[model samples]
Target chain A: IPPPMRPIPCKPLFFDLAGNHISYPMDEIEEKAGTSKKSPKKEGGGITGLVKGLWGWGGK
Target chain B: MTTPTAAQQKKEQEKQALYVELQKFCQSQDDTRAIKVASKILHLFPNDEVAFKTKIVCHVNRGMFAEALSLINDTSKLSGSVQYEKAYCLYRLQRMEEAKSVLDSWQSNSFKKVELMYQIHYRLDNFESAYDSLSDLLKTSDDEMDDERRTNLSAIAASLKLAGSSRRVKDIQ
Candidate 1:
């Protein structure tokens, strides 16, 4: 006859931490990664682009 | 066409056109447009009774009964038929005192006056009063009434009889 199957018990390897999956001090990590969050600046373009920019500013 | 004076002919044409516009507005339920057009007509011919009458009708259609009463207040200048029509509007607006006062001032020998009084009484739910008044008028004009007026009087009399019998039976039980 075949042997009866045995049950297996294992300890949990991972724990659910605090509020979200991400930890605090993310900006410190970003600095270590050599990345900056500043947006690119632009000079004046054509009249159409200027008008579009004015419209965008108006919408805001 | 040729015999009438130019001014008279022009005034007739204007009245005809105004009447057409009034009819159109009435059928289309365009009370605001009717008031504007009637106002313009009155401006052109200040003493035009028909235009003023049309204005009252427009006001009445728009549920502006107060305006209609104010416009129709110049009873001395208005034709008898116009005053009668104004009284009808007052009756519809449930202004029984105003309607009664106007009808009292009117001479009631004519069929129009009798009809107006009958309408007032009928609207007030005073069927017996209407019957009495109509009977008095019909009694006075039995020999002289034309066919249409006589027929109307007869119909009212029949209605009064029916109402009277039903009312008497109800009272008896």
Candidate 2:
């Protein structure tokens, strides 16, 4: 029987504008996405946590 | 019909000689020399097919993607090969979405097209789709597969394996 499929944890590789291969670290990407070092979960004071803390009553 | 004048005959002979020289340079893979001769030919016959193709190839080999793309744009009634080169230039410029769109529009089944499609899907994070395209390409007769194709197939397969193993390990942990 064929082996069960699994998702790969490989970093995505991209060709730069000059056709050069490049890959970015996941943490650096997440940081750029505003969810790593400064994530609300980490800081416990961002908009995400604030909303969660206030529950749905914070806003519709 | 009147016979050709001596001057016209001489000009035709010179053109033919230039074409022969261009063919030799191209066959030798001396792109720089080929470009020089091709430019001269283009100077005399602005729309010469051989000269145009040679110039575009020289530009591509020199990594002048923007120049190649511009030349392709300036051309009218693009041939299939020219369209393929245009798509290739877009791809090399890291315009993945646009490259994919251009490639999709072409209906021919060619090695370059398959290779480009694999790259586009792989870059889009569609690994399975990428693998599918690659496997389809590999299914062609061995005689038709060149060294580059073989290398690409192996590289992608190895990468897929590594990804799969890492995912499985994470699951186990």
Candidate 3:
């Protein structure tokens, strides 16, 4: 059945090494939900990679 | 106890290497090859938790619940718990009572668990409890999820009403 959409999908939950339950990461969740923010057309050959790299450092 | 001999140590090393290959296969979505590598690891070490789980996941992903259940049943112990997965397999197999009991065994609540319980209750024609479960889900959820669950709650309510009406009609008959 196609489940109702949520902040997270109602699926398997796993534990981290420390044993705290964790759901799927946002990117994987988005991808599974077909609502990914990634552009369909790749932006340049590698420019998007560079931007994501910069964002990962600054955003965190 | 005697220490593991060199041959046993070498076998352990090979198992570790196969696990690495299994990881790569899983990441690449090569579940077929991943299952083979995981089976190899399991052959070398039947008590391997990672290999057992990887194999189960591959089968579950393929919708081969029976195969996954076989693996789960054959193993006496899994280093990591696969209780939830076992419930899912039973649910898919249409063993509602078994599935419900497995879920009931859980002490804590999660969205998936509650949702599944709601489904199981609905299938068993226990509309009242199904509605209760959905309402519980509705109250706990927030924002985007709340709307969807509210809709589900109403649907379950409708079912509850329908079941009541049917019972009333039966009494009249």
lDDT by residue for model 1 over B65-125, one digit each (tens)? 6777777775447645356656666766789878878878876555666666765775565
Supply candidate 1's per-residue lDDT for B43: 73
Model 3 chain A, TM-score vs. native: 0.28
What tens digits encode model 2's per-residue C-alpha lDDT throughout B55-169? 8877887788899888888776444446667777887788888888888998877766777788777666666666677667666735533454555555555566765733221
Best model per TM-score: 3
Query: Pairing residues by index, what is the TM-score of model 2?
Result: 0.60
Tell me how far the alpha carbon of residue B170 in candidate 3 is from the true structure, in angstroms, after superposition: 28
For residues B1-173, write the lDDT of model 3, one tens digit per residue: 34568778689668656755765676677778978987887888887666677787777767788988877887858823666677777877989899789878976567777777777887787877877776676667565545555555555556666556442211110
Which regions of candidate 3 deviate over 4 angstroms?
A1-60, B1-5, B142-151, B165-173
DockQ of each: 0.00, 0.01, 0.03
Which regions of candidate 1 deviate over 4 angstroms?
A1-60, B1-20, B26-29, B74-76, B79-81, B108-112, B122-127, B133-173
The local distance difference test score of each candidate is: 0.55, 0.61, 0.62
Docking class of 3: incorrect
Name the lDDT value of residue B16 in candidate 3: 54
Poorest lDDT segment (10 consecutive residues) of candidate 2 chain A = A16-25
Which residue pairs clash in candidate 3? none
List RMSD in Å for every model shown. 36.2, 25.5, 13.9
